[model samples]
Structure formats: C-alpha cells, structure tokens
Target: MSLGDDTGQTRIRLPEGSDGDPYGGARRGGRSSSRSLVTVVGVVVLLIAAIAFANRGGDDSAAEEGAASADSPKAAATAPSGKKPVTTKAAGIPAGFTHDREGAQSAAANYAVVLGSAEMFTKARRDAILRSIIVPDRVADFEAELDKAYTPEFNKNVGLNEDGTTPKDFTFVSRTSPIGTKVTESSADTATVEVWCSGLLGLAGESSTNPVTSSWFTITIQLEWTSGDWKIVTHSQKDGPSPVPGDERASSADEMAKAVQEYGGFTYAR
Candidate 1:
C-alpha cells in the first residue's frame, strides 16, 4: 500500500498490478487471467440480481433488515433497547463517547472497518489510521506495539518494497469489505460484535511479486458506550467461514492493476 498526503487529506493507494499468491496457488497468466475477471464479474452480477429479487419479493426477514425503513441514515437504529452499559475508558478516548449501546456498537464497527483496511500496512499511514480509530488514551501504546509488529523485514515479506512503498508499475490491493454484522451480546453499555469480512490482498502488474488473492475473516470486537460514542475495548480475529472456491480463471496482472486504479473504496457503517 502507498500513502500520499494531499492538501491535508491522507490517501491510501492500492497496488497497481498483481503479485504473490497469498493462497499458495500457481502463478496465473494469459488465458487464466481473462477467465478470472469474467468469472468475478458474473458472480457480482448474479449477487445483485439475487438481492434485487429477494427485496422485490418482500422477504421481510427482520433479523437481516433490522429496522422497517431503509431510508434512515443509521443502519442499526432498530437495535434492541436494553440497559445503557458502562462505556467510559480509564485512560482512553472514551471520555468523549456517549454511554449508549447502539452508539458504542456503531462506533466499534466503523472503527474496525478503518483498522482492518489496507492503509494499516504502512508506518506513517498506519500510525495515523490507528490514531484516528483507537481510544484516545491507548493511542500511544497501540502505535508503539503496532510499530514493532510492522518491521522492515515484515514489510518486505508481505511484498512491499524495503521502504514500505509500492513499485511504480505494480498495484498493491489490500481491502476488507464487511458482509454483515451481528451483535452477539448487548447490555445497557457494552456489546460484543462480530463482523464478517471479505478481503483481497495481492499485487498486480507485469512481472510483479504479489498477485491479488482473497480471504475471509471474522473480526470480533468488545465495545463500551462511553462519553457519547461507542469505543472498542478489545479486538480479536479468526480465519473464516469461507465458501467453496468457484472454477473461474484468474485475471492478468495488467488487467487487475488497471481495475484497481479505476475503482475506489467506500466508507462503511453498521
């Protein structure tokens, strides 16, 4: 991932081309590349059609839709009104959060999305990203620990340049999109949330080192509603409840790289 500072906003750049296979597959090229892109596009199209059909049929599953109206800005507004849990942190930014369960869970889910993004791969960018999401008091500690984990050697191993930069011709793509969210436990002030995430990690370009591969992981967060918002107190992750692999062919390095450049990311909220 590449970090750029513009006017004052920070931007994270995805790899320009494809590289190493995180899933341990043989390097794919030529016909294989075209096939992969076609397959992915088809699957996405089918998914959209399926969702349209389901919604049009009035399959009102409350568990999935939660609130009756999709017009509301808050996706989780229909959450259960239980007790208002204790949400303040002894030393962190919880002093600014409101002590409400829904608010806390909302904050935790959004923060988790930011924390698990590709921007976390770079040192300076990673520090800023963490600082923006973590509780105020824990920012220093989190930064120190994260810095230790993101060593120069680690960056190289992950297909980054020694200086944690993306090569000019290559496009490194690391992203996580949340499929859904569940509040497993909730009280007046605390909640345990599970976010199902689909992630892509790879480099794309002619002669690149890391090709984009995909993975699924679930992130669990323990949250407390504090000050006036939700704050994450703890976080953990696990491999996945992945689906079976389809027989689609992989895309070429150049094609994948071009797509990355053409596309952008979204700001997700629960």
Candidate 2:
C-alpha cells in the first residue's frame, strides 16, 4: 500500500503505526485517523475460501504448499501464450487482452487495481470503468449499488468534497497495487482469477487531517469471454495474506506526496 516507484520498491514511508483495528469498513463508519483501514471492500467480502475447486497439491509437499502456495508463485501454476499484453485502454482501462488463462488473470488483476482506485469514487470515471470491465447485464446493478455506497458523506469522510474532488492545497491518494494473480478455474469461454493487492488511501499534505495509509486485500474476479474480450461477471474481496506490521520508520506527508507524483503505476501484465 506504499508508493511504488518504477523500480518496484515502496518509496513512501509510513509516518506511524496503529493500535486500532484496521478492518474498519469505509461505508459503515465515518473515516477515522487510520487512513490505512480497509477502504474499498470491493463487490463483497467472504473470509471462507469462496472458490470451491480442487486446490493444487500433493502429499510430499502438501504441508509446505497449501495456503502458502495460494499466494506464492509457482511455475506449474502459470502458463504463457506468447501473447503481448494489452496496450490500449477501452475507456481509460485496459482492453483487448488475449483470450486465455493468462489473459483472464491479467484482466482480473488490472481490474482489481482500478476498482479500488480513487477514480472509482467519482461518477463519470466510475461509470466508464464499470462499462468497460463489467459484464453487460450486471452493469446496472453494480452502478446503482456503488453509487449508493460512495455517497457525498463518504466522500467527505475520505477528505474529498461532495463532488469527489480534493481541496486546493491537498493531494488525494487512493491507489491499489496488485502483487500477483492466480487462476482458480478456466476454459474456452470463462475463467476466474484471484488478484492479490495492497492499497493506499487518504490525503497527503502538511495540514491534512487524513494522511495516506495502507491496507492489504485479495480480490476474486469471475470473467467471461464476450465482445472479443474478457469482462467481469462478479467480484469479491477477502482480508489479508497481509504481512505482519513492519517496524520501518514512517515518512512525512511531503515525502509521500512527492513519491506519488514522481512514480507512475504499471499496466500490470502477467
């Protein structure tokens, strides 16, 4: 959830650690001091392993492999199609990904990053993003539900105006970084992928009441091959494979803002 520079390292520093619960849902409560609290609980939340499919494992390495393998990258779990990553954005989001398991995972991972981004809070960008990634029939329901969730008061809670804009002197920060992607199921016409991600949410500046902070999550996106591309049918979130709180010293708001401005996010292929 820290600022990631082109070198793939976290450039932003955490100013402080917290003693309060980090699972506070943004919609249920007013924003608190811990800007690091889980902000966008995407489509849904379920702690139980939601995908009911055969997990890859064998007795010899079963104990060492089970849940660890869930997040870890293994050669057998990934395949290459000799296809180039999508280079175009349909409505500012990636589009025309290749039709295969890798393509599906790539779409899901990129979708996860966009869905949890600051852009999704605004009406215009949100609508465009939904139209580009979500399956057609579900678009209406998703848009209505999300519109209700990202209310004017919720915008205020996240340090934005009712119209989802930041005050003149402050910089808003809501970004998601996907660490890895895994396909849980796949075939010629449909696929499901889990995108492991960490995010930053809050505003950054000297006088800011809400400071940029971090959270960890995994998103499962079910996709279908339609209109010559993969589109989301459904998505859900679950809490961490989050690393234990680190002891690294936190950085100042100025440093955080500078890093965000200097760095550009990846298009996230593979």
Candidate 3:
C-alpha cells in the first residue's frame, strides 16, 4: 500500500487482499493500518510542537532584551548635564571654559563664531581675537595667515572697503551662529571639536551690489588646556551639511539691516 500521495494530502491505501468497505478489512490488516495512521499523526504533532516552542523562545529573548534596556541608564550624549557654561569674556568673546569634553566643544563653537564675524576681517580686532583664543606660540602664525587671507582685494569682494570698513550708506553684514558642537577626540590636555554653523555675509543696502546672504559651514578646532582655560591649537573650516533652501520671500535690505542692528549676538559657550 502507498504511504503518501503526490498531491500533498496524506493518504493510506488498504492491503491488496482487503475489501473496499471501511470495516470489512481483515483483523491483521486493520491493525497495521491503525499503526501507520498513528505514526503519521504523532510525527505531525511533534513538528507542530517544535514550531510553537521555537516561536515562544524567540519571544522570550526579545522580552528579556526589552527588560534589560528598560533597567539601564539613559543615554547622555544628547541630554544636558546641568553643568554651568563659561562665564568670563576676553576680547568681547567667551572664555575660560572648563577642562572637559563639553568645554572643548563650547570653546570650538564660540571660536567659530568670532572667527567668522566681521571683526575678523580687520587686522586689529582679528589679532585681538586670535590672541584671546589661540595658544601662545600659534597666535602669530594665525595672525599672519589671516592677514594674507583678508587682503584689500578680499575685503572689496565681500562688499567692504579696502580697509575692511563698511561703506557710508551700506551696512556690512557678517555674522556666524553656531548650531551645535561635537567632540571628536579628547585627552587630559587636548581635544578636537567640530562646530556646525550658519553665517550671514555681504552688504545690506538698497543699491548694494552684494546683498546679505546666508550659508552653512562646519569648523574644526583643536584645543589645548592652558592656564585653566581652553585655547585653540589649530583651526580649519569646511562647507556644510547644508539643507535645501526654503521657499520664503527674501527680506529687503532695510529690513535685514535693521534686524541685524536690533538682534545682537549671544555668548555661545552655553
């Protein structure tokens, strides 16, 4: 008698000597058919039990993982820790940051703001800013590099005078606002931090050739802990993680100039 059907349904064929009637088979043949049926049913039941057991095991593991996560401490990277920000100023910029990863990030952010400001285009203010934030041995190097970068031709290109002054009827708009900061590397005495920033530049006036425009960028500042404060060891900048520009209408030059005057920048160490 065949033990299986090709069409997927389980089938049992009675012995060749048995009659077609269900109860007319010989006693021996009936016993043999009953045993075969019982064996097949037992195998199917075992397979079903195994499948159910495996599913339950997976669920238990998932529940255990969820419980462990619930009992663990919350992530600290994105949350504030209630530490006070730096409260001192040098050369009109924030200074005296704590000697920690957070402090490095704060210093990097504030340095980015000042470095991208209109003041940095002028020699005196630029030197003052560099001296305030840069490490002692590196201050002169930074000044020299910036002096070459902010030459008369560069100043005129950004709609400023040859001497880095705003024209009489036009207001030069150069500002940098740091969006966030991250510490990429840190040690007991030195750290490297990246500051993501938004900036405004150009001249704001009705007849100005270069109207104020916004751009996004990131600044990397390597800092050293010195005299209980963070100072810049090296600094560099790169263009953004910028987002798509919005569809909002551009403000008039008068509105832009007035808003800049009314809204003074903040100390970003916090």
Residues 19-47 of candidate 2: C-alpha lDDT, one tens digit per residue: 44344333343545344334312211321
lDDT of 3 by residue, 67-144 (tens): 876425334342444667678898888988877877788788788888888889888899999999999999999888
Error of 3 at 33 (Å): 76
lDDT for predicted candidate 2 compared with the true structure? 0.81
Candidate 3 segments whose C-alpha is farther than 4 A from its true place: 1-79
C-alpha positional error of residue 85 in candidate 1 after TM-score superposition, expressed in Å = 24
Off by over 4 Å in 1: 1-105
**Alpha carbon lDDT at 57, candidate 2:** 48
Quote model 1's TM-score: 0.61
In angstroms, how far off is 207's CA in candidate 3? 0.7
- In candidate 2 the C-alpha lDDT for residue 113 amounts to 85
Q: Go through the candidates in order and give each one's C-alpha lDDT.
A: 0.67, 0.81, 0.84
